[model samples]
Target: GNATMGSGVDKHALERSSYEVLTGAADIRDAITKAEQAGYDLLPANADLTAAEVELLQMPQRERRLREALNSINGRYDYILIDCPPSLNMLTLNALVAAQSVIIPMQCEYYALEGLTALVSTIEDVRDNLNPFLKIEGLLRTMYDPRNRLAGDVTAQLSKHFGDKLYRTVIPRNIRLAEAPSHGQPALVYDKASRGAKAYLALAGEMLRREEMASAGA
Candidate 1:
């Protein structure tokens, strides 16, 4: 079983409980608990982690705090995913340092493309200095509105540069996608037949297939 994670994922308009989860706080070095009936284990995050910036600034190997914390429990999972915040920060740096690869889910917007450029550069810098094995696993098109001409143009630009690194699965803009989180459920669990759910399923399949192909090639 791959024990995947997506860290630093917060909502724009958080419910009271949601706000508490990120700012609710937990010990970083060893606070592992399973979330709900999701079967997957959860790692707690706290608002105080933001203060880790200054608190850890004077500490040695500050960039590796997260990596070290996770290493203690590395034997528990086959895979781990870290969903970082939008901006580059110590927390994000820790995630990149710990990760072997990254899957970037991007909205097809002009601004998003600019974000990608900066993110990619950061990845390269991290790969060269902090984590030599870091790789961009894939770029996913998200919130795709096929009717939008700008979305299409941005995607085409992305494909031109990323080529096979761009995933074939495009997650369309859907109400179900927005609603599932509010109900505290995954789209697949909430509405298995919904377009949002199906797109995500396809994305998972594509990722698995790529993994298989890479393993075979290796």
Candidate 2:
């Protein structure tokens, strides 16, 4: 099993290297870049479902693996961030089934409100159809630009609608964030003084405060 997993990563590495290391291209810009290099276009790498993965549900083996993976991670960490494939497939469904909370990272933009409705609907669907315990942990404002009038309007709307569910910390757009992944590290490791790094640190502290309050309540 580990061999299979290792090979998969090696395949991706070769795919990524084919452009960056060998051909000396842009080193696969984003997640989409790497997916395109692997000979698949329009691949749902973000947690969106496809037809095939849903069909595989007929096999009990798939379900067993899902359950096992979920059970394995329980209580092993304080937080398990499941970056689901950008599709509503079996994997996404399994993640929804397992996770008790969902943290949506969103940018403050004019059309961002339109996107939140879809995500909120999906969470509602998951709660109604699969995971009853699942609730939105919060909506984190990412790549925030306070100078943008649209951003301010969107943030105000979010605050009005979700109140405390809108985190006070807003992550500003920063080059350091764009640079860190190239070195295979978080922005904190790459540039502690960067605005993005400081924002994330503030988010962490806010989350910790919530955790403390929850523990006290318990």
Candidate 3:
């Protein structure tokens, strides 16, 4: 319906809160503290940070702002996730430096494959010069529709290239998943019976199973 949901967050609030913390007007802290869970933790995108990028350019070890902010709150969470803005910007470098592993979510399309090549190259550069701990953990195929032949072709190509690094679970394109965000909720909370919700649940299970296997193998 695209109607306004009463409980949705204000963009200005996120902008204000983020600017205060990021610029040290308030406290320097992990971006996680800025989130409001809509079923999963999400540090809402702060547009003000785009300006911070320029401010960072003149500073020493500028790429380490996010990494340093997060370090103070270490061991608070088993996993810390950052969704990067597209492009190899200063902010993206900060996340790569802070992360232990990278998960690349790709759409089953030729353009997305091309993007992966660029992302892989960037990851390699970060590993070589910035963050040695960073490595590809998984490549998740998103917005998948089996009816599309192009999708199948791209999936096959990804399998051939990535092999074991690609996750088996695919996130299918479903209306419920799309609709959930407008209502300020996760698909599972908005429509637990929906295919999108079920697929996510399956993905969660696969993630846990793989984590256990990795620990055993390690």
The model with the greatest TM-score is 3
- Point out the worst 10-residue segment of candidate 2 by lDDT: 1-10
Pairs of colliding residues, candidate 1: 5-81, 6-83, 7-83, 23-47, 25-46
Q: TM-score of each candidate?
A: 0.84, 0.70, 0.86
Displacement of residue 214 (Cα, Å) in model 3 is 0.8
TM-score, cand. 1 vs. native: 0.84
Which is superior by TM-score, 2 or 3?
Answer: 3
Ranked by TM-score from best down, the candidates are 3, 1, 2
Show the lowest summed lDDT stretch of 10 residues, model 1.
1-10
Q: For residues 1-218, write the lDDT of model 3, one tens digit per residue.
A: 01112124445455334445445554444433322434344344445667877887877787877787777778866776676777788878888998999988888888898899999999999999989999999899889999999998998898898898888999999998888877776566788899888988998799889899999999
TM-score of 3: 0.86
**Which is better, 2 or 3, measured by lDDT?**
3
C-alpha lDDT of residue 204 in model 3: 78
lDDT measured at residue 194 in model 2 versus the true structure, 0 to 100: 90
lDDT tens digits, residues 1-218, model 2? 12112112222333332112112232223222222222222111211224336444655554234434446436644564555554456666666777888888888876767878887888899899776898988889999888889888898899899988988888999988887755544466668899888998999899889879889999
